[model samples]
Structure formats: C-alpha cells, structure tokens
Target chain A: MGIYLPIAEISVNVFVLLAMGAAVGFLSGMFGVGGGFLITPLLIFYNIPPAIAVATGANQVIASSVSGVLSHMKRGTLDFKLGGVLLAGGIIGSTGGIYVFAFLRRLGQLDLFISLLYVVLLGTVGGLMLVESVNALRATRSGAAPVLKKSGQHNWIHRLPLKMRFRASKLFVSVIPVLGLGAGIGFLSSIMGVGGGFIMVPALIYLLKVPTNVVIGTSLFQIIFTSAYTTLVHATTNQTVDVVLAFLLMAGGVAGAQYGAKAGQRLRGEQLRALLALLVLAVAIRLAIDLFVTPPNLYSLSAADLN
Target chain B: MRAPNAFATAVVLSLLAATAPAKAQVPLTEGIQIGLSTDNVSITAGFSGADLTIFGSLENPDPLVARQGRYDVIVVLEGPPKPVVVRRKDRVLGVWVNLDSETFENVPVSYSVATTRPLQDITEPNSYKQLSLGASNLYMQPADAGDSPATIEEFTAALRSRKAATGLYSENVGGVQFLSQNLFRATVRLAPNVPVGTHKARAFLFKSGVFIKESSAQLEIRKSGFEQSIFRVAHNYSFLYGIFAISLAMLTGWLGRVIFRKD
Candidate 1:
C-alpha cells in the first residue's frame, strides 16, 4: 500500500495519496480551480518539506492545466494572442522568482515565509471574493440577473501604453496590464505552486474585460507554460520536485477532473462562485490560525548531522 | 543547487591531507575478520529502518593483555558527509523565526558506534582524540569558527543533539557482545530517514591502550527497481527529467480526456 517517493526520499501510502488527489481534484472540478493552493498546504501539514511540496504542486498544476486547456482548445475558445503576451511575462517572472526562492531557502526562512505568504494571499483574495460572490448571489435570489462587467469601460488599464489587439477575445486593450498580471501570477506560481486561475480568470473578466467564455481557456493556456517553467526551474536549481509524488497526484487528478467537469454543468454561475468563495475562505482561515498558533516543534533540523 | 554530499568533500580532504602525511603510527587493521549481514543494502519502497549486524573476530594472541582485560573492540558505521545547518528560533512579532545559524561542513550524514565496553573507560583523552573514537571528537569545523560572536561550542551542541534525536548519530557502549574468546558481533541501528549513498563500516582492535589495526568495509545503500531509475534521472539529468515530468503529465491529461470523453 506504500509507495516510495524517490526524490522526496520518503514512503507514503499509495491509497491515501490517491484519495488526497481525488479530494483536491473534486474541489478543482467543482470550483474551476487548480487546487494547488489546497494541496501544497495539505502536503506541508503532513510534514512534507515546503520546498518539495511547492515544486511537486507546480508539477501537478502543469497536468491539470494541460488537460483543461485541451478541452478548451477542442471548443476553439482559447485566445492565443492574449495568452502569448501573458506567457512572455510569466516566463520572465518565474525565472526571477526561483532565484529569490533559492536565496530564502539558504537563509532557512523559506518555510515560515511560505506559510505567511499563503495566509496573507489567501486571506485577502478569499475575503474579497466571498463578499463579491455573496452580493452577486443575493442579487440572483432577488430575481435580478447578476450584472457582468461590460467591455470598453474606460479605466486605468485602458490608459496604459503598448496597445495590442487580441482578435479572439475581441479586446484592443494595452499589453501592459496583461504583462503585469502575467508576471504577478508567474511570480506566485514558483513560490506558491498555483496555476493562478483563481486570480487570473477573475482578472480577465473584470480588469481586461475578456469574454467570459474565453477567459478560462486563456488562463489555462497561460498556466500550462508558466508552471512548466516553474517545474523545470525547481528541478534543475533546487532539486526539490518529486516526480513520483507528482505522478500519483496527476493520475488521480486527471481521472477525477473528468467527473468534476461533468458536475460543473449542474450549478448556476453565482452558486458555483459562492461555493468556491466559501471554500477559499475556509482554507484561508485555517492558514490564519496556524500562523497565530504556537507550533508544536519550534526548532527544526535541516541539512546533515551524520556525526 | 544541490550541494555535493559529504563523501565528496571527505574524499577531496583525505587526498589533500594524505600528501601532507600525519605522524607515523601503527595502522589500525590487525588480524580482524569482519562481515556485514548484507554488504549492499537495497532500499525499496517497503524500507523502514534496518538493523546492521557487524560480526567480526579478533586474533588476540597476546595472553598478558587478555588476562588484564585490556582488550576492546569498537565497530563504527558512517554515512556520506554533508553540511549541517542548525538555527535558533526567536519570537519575532509573536511568530517564531530562524535568526542565527551556524553551518558545519563535511560531517557524516549518519554515524553509529558500538563497542564491547564504554569508550571513555577503554582509552585516554589523547588516544581517543587521535582515533576519533567518539562522535564529539570528529573534525567537524564550523563555517564561522574563526568569526566573532559565532561560537564553535554552541554549533556543535546543536549538531550533536539534533543528530542524536534523529537516531542518526548514536553510541552503544556495551552493544558489541562477544560470542567467544575471539569472536564478537555488534548491531547498529539505521533510521529510515538515513541518506542513501555509499556508507562505510569500520572495526578496530585495541590492546593495552596502544594503537592497533582497523578493518573497513563498504556498504552500498541504493534505491532499488523503479525508485532507482527515478532517483538517477532526477539527480543526474534533472533538466531532461523536468521536461519528461511535464510531458508525462500532459500526455495523461490528454489521455484522460480521450478515454473519459465528454459526458
């Protein structure tokens, strides 16, 4: 029942790992999320080192995003022009993030830093999303269609330079905002192991006003390359990515996502958003508590002490 | 970057130190027959912890030393070396954070010692230091040894306690039990978390507190089957391995869509 992870150098139960992958996959399917945020924290909670957890989580994201993108491609929904611009920034940002990751690891503050970063990021993102989704749900219940952000609305993003036309999304917005958004997500991808869908899909819908139909596909496309780059960086530089652990997770994740995609059709947009908001908030709350709570083992030992 | 392991460091140092040879003394490897239960240990997925029994015989020909009970047998096992970093956590804004740290380079990843009797009772301080009989007597130099404010004593204490806690570095004073007048066997416990590499097991024979012969054998602990292939690919060809991982994931993702179909 136990499988040894070659890179992680530990033995974990195969069934338990599969079940965990299924649980996270189910959430991703239900909420249109990558579940990296959930899985990485769970791995860390189980005593897997933060470095390995983050790297392997990114590896899984590459799998999830690839399949998600393929389905979108079949439907001809991806905005390749838009995805390309973002990917250019993403690659650059991720490469830079790895150096920062290596530096923090050497100083032995990577673990604490990762936890605090998650607490802050998840708290802010989850809190804002929950408030917005709750109000949108309330509007739907009152027999009013929740209003979607309209295109061509003048904003700060519109005023930026380096304008480019994205034919598929039918947007002529400036490339600056797209690049910045891509860079931010790419930076987070290496450190946090997320596909950045939770952040990206929402940004495309509101900030860039991309068509909702194409937003998910475009985000997945960008995620595929970004996380793949992150995986390579971690493997070559930090030597932290565990291929065996990633393989087990992807096996369960790919299968579970099929069921998840089918289940997603049953819910209304606002209802689904509401559920996702609640789930994100719950994870954020858990992280917050861990930060404030006194850890059982304050002193951690690392490196080697053979003699 | 994945730092070079302790074995690599030791080999380089030993080669350099050999050129500037130390004091001439009786080499420790006199009349001893030693065997490990399995010289090459294969670590499969089912590997937890293992017990390594070092069975050896000593040819104690000197009758006077045996009559006086001045003969002892010490068996030691050492894993490949790597740097160890120990840090003290301080409360910063109510969240614990690592502040000060000391790094000890070229220390064994794991070291286990078993002897017929207590190490201290068998040898004097000068003799023990020269032989490196005890764990504390290792030549583990702190990176900041000569620097101000970073004491060697503090770093070594942290290193010793931490390794002891993990069962990596241990000492069994009476672990080496004798089956007969010239035969002895000792069991050294290795934790599951022990690093995988070439380990060294050494046995020393002493008489009347003078230097004697020592015999050493190699113990190869490597990942077996699929784990072996995976470990080699990851560490050896990491860049290609990364690409392979991504490709495999993408392939599975695509295969999933093909098999499951749109429901």
Candidate 2:
C-alpha cells in the first residue's frame, strides 16, 4: 500500500528567499551600502519571523562586507588608524544598543519602535541623499570638481577640548566629536539590527569630514565588529544565531560582492551615489507601503506563544 | 461578445466558490441518547434494560416516542462505592494496625455491590482508578436481567488499551472523577504531537453485563506561532542574511573611497 502525505507537511517555495537575497545583494552592490533599510523589511513582508529575520540579516551583512573591505584595502583607501578609533566607540555603543534592544523586546514594543525608526530615518535620508547626489552629478557634468564639505564648522563640536589629528583621512577633529559620532552610529546599529554603514558613512563624510577613502573602511571595520558581537550575543542569549543559515547566506554574499565591486569600478562617484540614493528611496517607499497598507491576515500568533 | 460575457461570468462564479466557506451540516451523533443525573445518583440510557416499558399519556397517545430505545440505569444502594485497602504491620505493642486501609474500611459491615458489568469493564475513565481492599470484603455481581451475559468484553478491552496507549505529550482536556456510582468523567488531554485539526473522543458506561450509555466530545487543535518560528529559522534565515551582508559591503566600500578622496 502507498502512504500519502498531507499537503501542509510540504514546505513552501525556498526560491522566494533566495530571490529576495539576490535582489538585495544587487542593490547593495550598486549602491556600495548596506541595505538593511530594505532587507529587514522585505523579510517581514515575506512573513519571516521577526527575531530570526533580524539575527539572520546580521549574519548576511558579515559576508557582504568582507569583499568590499578587501577591495577598499587594496585601493590604499582604508584608513586603519581612524577605523580603529571609530570602532572602539562603535563597540561600546553597540553593547549599549543591545541592552536597549533587549529592554524593548521585554516591553513588547520593539517592533513598533523598529518600524517607526525605519520609516522616519530611511525616508528623510533617502530623500536628502538622492537630491544631493543628483546635484553633484549635474555639477560634475559641467566640469567642476565636487567640493567636499568640512565637518569642523559646528562651533559646539569644534570647541571641545582634546583635538586629534586623523592623518590618513586628512583631518584634525576633536576626539569628543569623533567619539560621539561613533557612539551614535553604534547605538543605531545595535538597536535597529543594522551595522549602520548607510548612516555612518554619510556622518563620517559630511559630519566629521573624514576623507571618502577612509569612510568605507572605517564603517566596514565597525560593522564587522558590531555585527559579529550582535550575532554572538543573540546566539548566547536568545539562541537565535543558526550557523548553517549564516554560512549559506555568506556563500551567496561573497560572490555577489565580487561582482558588485567590479560593476562599481566602472561607475563614476556621482553616478554611483545617485543610483544608491534612488535605491534607498525605493526601499524606503516600499517599507512605507508595507506599514500603511492593509494587512492580509488580521489575526496572527504572538511571538511569546507561537505554538 | 456573448462568449466574452459568458467567460467573465464564469470567472466571477469560480472566484466566489473558491473563497466561500464549505457547508457545515454534519449532524451530531444520531443513534445515542445519553443523560446523567446532577446528583451523580444514576446514569440512565434509553436502550439497555431487558424489558421495555412504554409509559402512555392520554393526550399524546404515542408512547413509542417516549420509550423507543432500551433504558440502562446505574444505581448505588447507599452512595458511591468506597474501596479501602488496609496494610497491616506488627507494632511494638504486639498488635498490628492496618495502615493501608482507606477511611471507608472503618465501617464494619460487608457490602454486596451490584454493578451493570464486571469490575474491569466499569473502569472506563482515562485517569488512574484507585482500588482499595479493607477488612470488610466487597463483592460485585451483575444483576439477572434481559441483558446478555457479557459478550462485550472485546469492545471494553479495545477502549482500555486505546486509553492506556496515549503518550505523555497528550493533553487531558476531559476530566475524570467518580461523581457517584453511575457517573465517571471521561478525560482525554490533547497531545502536543496532535496536528492542528479536529479529533473525536468517546466514553461508554457499562452496567449489568450490557452496554448502557455512551458520550463523546469533539476537540479542535489549531497551529500557532511557535511552529512558525521553527520554519522561519530553519528555512529562511540563510537567504535573509546573504542579502544583508552584500549591501553592507557595497555601502562601506563606496563611501570609503569618497570620504578618503584627497583635497
């Protein structure tokens, strides 16, 4: 006699997950930025369980950044000294962020806070970055060098004592200012389940006046540290990190990064920034739709009692 | 034009049929009539006694409607049967007291208990049944009635084995209790391994060597979020992480070059 299996026993499409991963990977490559602004929300859209989705996204970031970091290092663009300083603050800030995240989870308000932050931060930044990049591209086509802005203009930050020279990034900024920036980025990274590269890279280039060459390296270093710590912490505390899942994503990410870097080489800085800005705007819009649109399923299982 | 209109109508009809809930007209058990007294004195069924008595009403005149099936009743002469087991050990005073005896054993007269069937068949409830033997001997025998002398042993054994085979994960949703002689709570705990679906539970009471009353309850178990967690992590995490890592890498590399550009 033949045994029959029930339909529910079969799994849904796995390719959906792989396709989403590839799409996010393509955007991340084109923009030269982390797409947590997009990836995390997409996971939720696909009905992935939130905690596992956040933890797994962190794992994927680790893979995605490795090749990008290597390419920047090879280009003599990586500022190791400044990267180290920003990283120290990022580590402390991320640790604090984890505590805040855990506290929010206990209060049962983490998802609300995360969604709100995504909408506000991603929307504003995406719009501003897009407009600025388009202007830069227009300016470049007219044969003018895009003038980089100075960060020490803020009198309050400039007035702080203990100024330090960042030789590789070619700036002399106050240690307090750098530390404050690092800490803010770290906290955001930890709480939002992101490495905060998209946020930090701009803050470094515009807020702190770190040379563009140093921004990616420093951000990558910080992300590598924060995400590794976040992954380990989530694993030990929530038992959320699954190594098998991490490895599979890493496999795809590493290859994707290589291809992305090659494509990035052919793009002018202004063109790349404009494209990235558009991508971020698109992701931000998609997330807004998710938040405001009517949900298909009104009744859902709570996280605490899923069974 | 007519064909296109017909196709659109067919599509609309199919969509409505697909979304509508299926009809739910399954009737409750059709053949059994079960009733229990509130005081737990007796359980009476319509179809168990040897001779049927049809009580007549002048106004209605159709007595068969009132007593169409056999009636089986469970009765306790005094109250519920109390089994007491006493354990005896010699004390330092050279007199042994039965420590294992239940409080019921203190009453000194032998009680002749008449039941519907053998002691084994009466043990229908799923919970552990405590049987006690005391100084006074207790005897149980089936009454002589029109009921057959116990060909239902096979059925009782099947039920007992099924009840005993339930695994540890099973939930005991129905309660078990000896409310009185004729009443027992037929308890079944829904098992964790049970799929999210509907299940049926049956409880039967026997007396005087015949099947008397059978009662049943339906249980519905629904799948919840915990099950989804296993699927999300087990299947979805890898792809999620893959995309996140790649985007982060690109962001860092591009921004690194721009920030580091020389004056």
The digit string of per-residue lDDT tens for model 1 on B171-228 reads 9888888776567898887878777898999988888766577888999887789888
* Per-candidate interface DockQ score: 0.39, 0.02
> For each predicted model, how many residue pairs clash, with residues at least 3 apart or on different chains?
9, 47
- Winning candidate number (TM-score): 1
lDDT tens digits, residue span B1-263, model 2? 85456456545554665676242211211133222222111111111111111111111111222132212222211112222221222232332211211111222111112222333444433311222211111222212223343422322232223323432112222133333322333323322223333433333333223443444333333333433443344345544533343455445435433443221
In model 2, which runs have C-alpha deviations exceeding 4 angstroms? A1-14, A141-155, A297-299, A303-307, B1-263
Clashing pairs in 1: A306-B108, A306-B109, A306-B110, B6-B81, B28-B213, B28-B214, B29-B213, B29-B214, B30-B213
| TM-score for each predicted model, relative to the true structure | 0.88, 0.54
lDDT per residue, candidate 2, A1-307, as tens digits?
1111111122224455555655666667666776555667776666554565566667567656654676677777877777777777877787787788777665445665676677778888878888888898888889898786554466466667888887888877788767777777778776666667888888887777677777887687667766766665564445444443444444444545555665777898778877777777776777666556554422221223111
How does model 1 score by TM-score?
0.88
DockQ of candidate 2 is 0.02
Stretch of 10 with least lDDT, candidate 1 chain B = B21-30
